[model samples]
Target: MRPPLAAVLGIDVGLLQSGMGGVAGAELACAVSNAGAAGCAGGYKLVGAPLSAMLDRLGTGTDRPVGINLIPEVVGAEELDHQLTQVLDETPPHVYVSLFGMPDDKVFDRVADAGRHLVVQVGTVEDGVRAAGLGAVVVAQGIEAGGHLLGTARRDELVAALRAELPDACIAASGGIGSPEEAARAVAAGADGVLLGTAFVVAHESRAHERFKALVTAAGESDTVITDVYEIGWPGRRHRVLATAVTADPDQPKKFIGKTVVEGKPYLVPRFSAAVPTEATTGRIEEMALYCGLSCSAIPAETSAADVVAGFAGVLPGSPAVTN
Candidate 1:
């Protein structure tokens, strides 16, 4: 068996919440990290003064070590540079999970210079091995994962494959492992930890809309669809979302469907804007993107982030043979 993620991640628990864009903020991050799990801020497509301000707010809210996730390839060079500078300038997170692409030596060195762990999300064994060679931890993301998917393999298969390929590499499983039981199964299957996203989307501390939360709560495994329907800012990427009304309409224009003010500035909202809906989203509720995983079946109608973390800690893997 491998060492628990708590030892490797410097966090108290073996679970890590996904850095869900717009959904996870300081409030949710602080709550989860304080509960012993690693909390992460979604830093995708975010930059400039706004990014700095968000980090400042997160820093002020929690003294615990929190992480920030970035997809360098998805975000342009200018945006990536500005976002990195902003985070490094003020409060650099305790960990940096780079997804979609690998960061160059300079970026890796910068993260190490800030005394943070570099985590790379990989879908295949080749990528996992590559990331391990770069002295970075690997997150084995399966196809069942919500939002932006990484790999086409099943979660257990990916975790087992990654562990077999890199026995010494620290490996975590993300995707469909949602419940405490599933989390335990991943650990038993050779994963050092589990990264949960959909389960926590319904958490009280999450910044998602009430309607979105309700839809997730009522959704089942068959209710989700993975497509590039909402590819306004980030294109050619497949994201798993609920089969809402907008997804049914193929000819929906890529215009601002709604308008909301951010930091006292009004911004036009596009399809899948990565901007979480609020009371101000004056548009068709079911027409917007609703990202979720098949694991939504295990989420309760209402639960606290602390409670969710604690619940996972109490669960024990059923049996090695069963989990395997």
Candidate 2:
């Protein structure tokens, strides 16, 4: 039998790929889903045509379950509604919606009304209970998570707490989980599954820039630090990233450091921007926000997304072999 979380997600494995902005695009998402694990594409600040195009590609890429991640803190309510609307219209029923933070009742109701599955990543047990009550699967995010800091709790501890509070809920653990051993440890700690970001960041199908993948693969235990320096685009939020010269000094002059093309639209990346380096980004890549977790220490090289998922199948309880 599949694990509770995996069954809830309609996947063969309990492992989930994080919807990392600029990294987890359609190719990566399809690769993971084809491997029998749940996959997600980052829906960061995308609206209208770009969002619709991506959704269309994801809908056609794989028949397995997939999700689109949206951060409520990054986009306004009106924009989020628009994004959600387009997502519902453009994708099939199998494409679920995932939220990084706790969304308001209206947002939860919207997804529920559409009879679609909702996954909400939360930093606290209270939020997990609330999300479960709202009929959504809950992802317990720990402090070790890369990109954005959801809470200060440790991964195992948070998962344990959520389990204690809601025994029947489909709870997954996120943060600092890079290897098969770590995934097993999370399950031992009461998580129904594990969600990994750093491990997939180096996947060949990931859209992360080559330089970013190189840095993550070469990173050590102490290479990452949590800070708010790279918060121009999404300010006041702390995130864990590889220590760069820009992070070393927060007062550096704000300037355009790079350029990136998203959904065929080019945009200049300013210094301290929250934008991650992708294949479409160029110029001073190392100085930008290089989101990484302690899990980077385990990701030794770039590999296919299918291989990444296969690595964890053995460790995840009830996880089946990858069909691909």
- Measured by lDDT, the strongest candidate is 2
| lDDT (Cα) of model 1 | 0.75
Candidate 2 — number of clashing residue pairs? 0
Winner by TM-score: 2
The reply for model 2, stretches above 4 Å from the true place, is 1-3, 321-324
Scanning candidate 1 in windows of ten residues, the lowest lDDT window is 315-324
For residues 1-324, could you state the per-residue lDDT of candidate 2 as single tens digits?
324677787788888889988899988998899998989999999999899889988999999999899998889788888999998888999898999998888999999898788999999888889998998888999988889988889999999999888878888899999888888789889888889999999999999999999999999869999999988889888999999999898899999989999999999999999999999999999999999998998989999999998888877655665232
- lDDT per residue (tens digit) for residues 146-254 in model 1: 8877667888898999888888878888887668778877877888878888888889998777888899899888999988778776777778888876777757676
Go through the candidates in order and give the clash count of each.
Answer: 0, 0
- The true-versus-predicted C-alpha distance at residue 135 of model 1, in Å, is 1.8
Cα TM-score per model? 0.90, 0.97
Q: With candidate 1 superimposed using the best TM-score fit, by how many Å does residue 10's alpha carbon deviate from the native? A: 1.3
